[model samples]
Target: MDRKHVLITGGVGGIGVELVRLFAQAAYRVSFTYRPGEESRQRAQALLDEVGEEGMHALELDVGDRQSHARLMDTLSLPLDIVIHNAGVGTKTVERAAATYKEQDEVFFRVNTLGPLWLSEDVIPGMLARGHGKILLMSSVDGGITHFPRFRAADGMSKAAVAFLGRQLAATYACTGIDVFTVCPGATDTPMFQASTLDALSAEQRRLLEASLPGGRLIAPREIADLCFYLCRDEARILRGAVIDASLGLGVCPAVMG
Candidate 1:
């Protein structure tokens, strides 16, 4: 098949990097974003080097800056076929939120929620004009975006809002053959998982935590990536506006496996 352009935000981090690897290998012309300085740049380039730089492009971007999307629209020489909205961070903002919920709201919102919104808004219009495109919003399997419990107040609220954003956007544009998928992958083994709040627990506690899962372990990063690749295909475009969960089995872990 002919290669198409695919853009992934946060494409330097653990799961993000893996997604880059997967998409590039699948023969998509890939463009990705990174924000931190040289170290991150080095790592991303190294990964691409291992793959020989064909059908891959990486650049630094602040996804929070919606205005930049305008620049991308103007400067991009190629049409984008797939976009994976993966720029976000959470699960350890407890202390930060406690101290500055108001101040930090924009930070989290921009990176986690608005980034995708702006990207989708900018990209989908062009998609409608072309009558073909696939977009996926990378979310968490921690909870359904709607009907979030009270315990995970902030993260839940933000994710829920973004989920609605994705849903509404998909509904608005689905008629034009522009597809959108809300992707929720479970706790995948990556740097984010390594840096998780659960890391504070003892090894036994970690094992106990694993025991709570039906798989008795965390989800694999590659698993999420492969699923992402699946969703972005033209064939999977029919699944638009669907909440596709890459979770092992949430809220129903069988005791024997756990």
Candidate 2:
């Protein structure tokens, strides 16, 4: 079988990085986007080196900008078979819940929600025409069944909406051979968690938080990537609209983490 074409957004985050590496190593035409950061560029270069020039490419992409998808298509110069919507934000502007939803910044909606919709919609037509495509969504467990403390209504609603959008898209494009899989990973050991406002919790509070999870440890990015790798393949074509949790069996360990 020929290698597939794949694109990943937020391609340098911990999970995104592993996705890039896994797909590139699999010999897929791997492309990822970063929003103007040296660390992102350097990491892209390193991934390219690891993949060794078979079909790895990196581009500057601001997912919030709908026009960037057009630019991405122009830059890639090929039909995409797999698209991973991995660019997102899990942060909340306010510390507590309010009576009504309020906007904090344009970025929260633009990057986390609308951007994926824009990209997926733009690519769906092409996938329909070709009768082959795979779209993966990187949502969070907090957006699914689990509850988060100090959660923003926008983030939760947006991700849940994204998942629903994927499900609807799958139903709409079922006969076209496109699979829409939503991945919900919990408390990954990424920069997002480290930089989370909850990091300010007292030592005992933090321990209690860790104790809530079954594994007693944060989920690794690679585990999520491995699942994504499987999902991106043609073999996983039946996993449409499915939400896979890669949270290290969280919410179920007896022991607590320090």
Candidate 3:
């Protein structure tokens, strides 16, 4: 049997890397996207090497760029059996007094919300033709299902739209063999999480934050990857359109952010 092909965006990122590795190990032909840059290029190459080259490929992509989305679709040789919209921008500390919110908010919406919309449009036709496909949209607790203060509102707004998008697609593709779902992860242990929320904190504050979490630690990228892998399986189609809270306990408790 031919291996199933999967395309994962932001493959150089913390969760993205784990997703790529898991899918590749499951005997899938993995095509993952990385932003075009020297650093991303090096990381992508390293991941490719680690996963072995035979069934793994890396493509340059800027999720926020429509032209990049077109270029990516044009470059694919395999019809995607699974597409994970994992690329996203992290929340920045909102500067309420500054006028920069509008500019920054545009970027959040473009990459986090619209990127998946555009790419799904391109891939869904192929999926429809084949009679089966899986799509996973990576969202977060904030704006995906719940909200926490001190973070940019745009970040949450963009992710909430992703949750809605997943449900809408699932409904549209119901019974057509296309399964769509959204995962809202909590404070995950990724560079983005560290930089956005933890890096500036003192040791005491960081410890307190960890203690507040359900597991007394950040959610591991591998945990999320495993969940995603299963969600794409044929059996998981029953969960179609579900907006899962992968947040442990943080989704219900905004106090954890303090």
Task: Say which candidate scores most in TM-score.
Answer: 3
Off by over 4 Å in 1: 68-75, 93-99, 143-152, 251-258
Q: lDDT of all the models against the reference?
A: 0.73, 0.74, 0.89
**Model 1 residue 142 distance off true place after TM-score fit, in angstroms:** 2.9
Compared with the true structure, what per-residue lDDT tens digits does model 1 show for residues 19-71?
88887777778888876578779987887887668767777776767766666
Please give the lDDT score for candidate 1.
Answer: 0.73
lDDT of 1 at 138: 82
| Cα shift from native, residue 232, model 2 (Å) | 2.0
Q: Quote the lDDT for 125 in model 2.
A: 84
Clashing pairs in 3: none
Candidate 3 residues lying further than 4 Å off, grouped into runs, are 93-99
Query: For residues 70-186, what per-residue lDDT tens digits would candidate 3 score against the true structure?
Result: 899889876889999998887652232124878778888888999999999999999999989999999999988798778878888998899999889988998798889999999
lDDT of 2 at 53: 64
lDDT per residue for candidate 2 within 1-258, as digits (tens), equals: 867889899887779889988887777888888765687689777767776766778888877777776787678746889999998766642222123345443466677778888898888888888888899988777665354646666676776767677777777877768889888887787777765634778878767776676776677889889998888777887677787766676523212322
